[model samples]
Target: MTSGIPDSIMALVVKQDGYNPNPEGGIHFETMEPYLEFKEIAVPDLAAGQVLVGMAMAPINPSDLHFLKGEYGQPRRAGKPAGFEGVGTVIAAGEDPYAQSLIGTRVSFAATPDGTGTWATHAVAEAMLCIPQPDSVGDHDAAGFIVNPLTAAAMFEEAKAAGSPGIVLTAGASQVSKFIVALARDSGLDSICIVRRDVHNQVLTDLGATVILNQTEDDFAAELTSTMKERKPRFFIDAVADATSTQVFNAMGKDSTWMIYGSLSPETPPLPNTGELIFRNKVIKGFWLSPWLSGAALDEKLAVFAEVQARFSDGRWSTEVGATVKLDSAVETLVEALADPRGKVFIQP
Candidate 1:
């Protein structure tokens, strides 16, 4: 037990009513404020093999907003705090040696399914789930450590396993997609990147992307078809699920798989063309990080963590934080963060 740690601390609580039935077409300041509240709460008791983390920083990810809207894969209860991953200092721990050893060290942690989340000043997490951060990794980078990097690595690994000559990725300008581009370059695999604007082309090309197509261009379909002919990409990673998803799916090679990981668009993607599916042997699937990480072997999980940490240490993989907000100003800051498309936003609790 840590004698100096406070018994009570401030936290951002998400009530059941937090889900906005209509998010004004999408999540905005007005829609999100009614759902999130800041209040003082009792620190959670540490269970065996658990540690109490004094949260330093947490990012406002797209999934966090989806979770607030109650659209996530797992169910979130009322009166629970909101946040998926963050970096913090372990001030207290339970009886386990591994848990106790984490005390005084800063680590990155993902929120427990049924417990307090990282949006609070204090959060309790399983010691094994808390990966100790090296001195070289900053709080901002560490806060985003678990989600994007690991998912990118896993996606690339899966593509490699399929023995595909190259992979097609939508939302090429997103942070995870950027990581995928870098990972593919390092692995000597080609990546066909699809973005919504022409401005994103040079940046993605600089990131080692093999081909960059602007989805907004008048000749987008033509460019995509020609690129498909040259690349013959066997795997398509879809994040923006809309009409573009159907177009990309139809363009993929025969027997190719389209993995849908995120839905940035408000409208659901139209059904795949039956002719293509029946004759081309195309498949559509979903990929969620939780199950993918949970099903991974312990050694494999540790290896991924080690790889991510090393990448952060060497500046190979990183996240750009646009702004940081205190717990009290989260609502307004989140709106501002959402408006900015360039970088992520962090919460310093």
Candidate 2:
């Protein structure tokens, strides 16, 4: 156990009370008295190459919602604390090659195996799992930047690898979409950003998106088809998976790659047509950033931050648009944010 941090720490606990008639059943939230009252076990002792970090901030990402609802991925065996990515300050370190220099540093990173998530106040993790944050970056920005920025980078890399001229992003104006827009702009790559409403157009356009289309408008398909009439979009990344959006993908020329990464439509399940793949030579792929990033090289992961930080500092990428909430109000903030598409809910500790 560590010297000062104490055995128990204030944490969000989830338990499987019972099943419900509704789909989102079997999960519940409760704030215990305090850290010390729980099991009274020792604080997690640092192992060789391990470090103790006090989580500073973490976002309620879509996957986090799934984790909370016990829907996506394998359902947790039973009760478990949940979170995916976070920025934390190191308080102690174990014997390791990297420990000497990493102590007392704030880092932004992601971890797995459920218990090591970023949802709590303090976490003990391997030193390699922590990516040191620059002194220039604020804690809030550092926390919010980790996952979305990396996803945006990966998407761009995927598109470029396919020799695609431009990229198409569903769920435009989302925290991730905005990052994609900024990243694409900086790389001088053309992109079409799709939003569900006309109201979202100007916001994304002002953020440097050249082409913005409304998914609900009658002319939506025509607009997309006419714009890309000469050349079909080789890459389509959908964060919004609706039957209508899939229709758009179906209309694209053969030999195109459509990646489905999200399901913004609550009622519609993604149903891909087989003929497109068989006859049109099209491909439909799914992506989940967490599993893909597991076991990636440290240098490769750190590179994401270096690029994202550079863009953020230069005004090419932004983190200011999201709604910010203090740590104490975190649960309420998350509930409200999850109910609406207002913006990402950022919790500061």
Which candidate achieves the best lDDT against the true structure? Answer: 1
Tens digits of per-residue lDDT for model 1, 25-140: 22334456666788788777778788888899998887887787767776656667888999999998888999889899999989876457888898888898899998899888
**For candidate 2, what's the RMSD?**
4.2
Q: Give candidate 1's TM-score.
A: 0.95
lDDT of 2: 0.67
Q: Per-residue lDDT for 1-349 in model 2, tens only?
A: 2343645555444444222225542222343222101111235557777777788888767765545555565454333344567788887777786864577799876755523555666766678767787777777667876677888887777787887767788887777888877767777776788877776677687777868888778888788887666545778888867776677677677788988877656556455688888998889888777665875666776687678888766666766445665555555455554445566666555
- Candidate 2: residue pairs that collide: none
* Ten contiguous residues minimizing lDDT sum, candidate 2: 32-41
Displacement of residue 298 (Cα, Å) in model 2 is: 4.7
lDDT of candidate 2 at residue 142, scale 0 to 100: 78
Give the 10-residue window scoring lowest on summed lDDT in candidate 1.
22-31
The true-versus-predicted C-alpha distance at residue 49 of model 1, in Å, is 1.2
lDDT against the true structure, each candidate? 0.83, 0.67
Evaluated with TM-score, which candidate comes out highest? 1
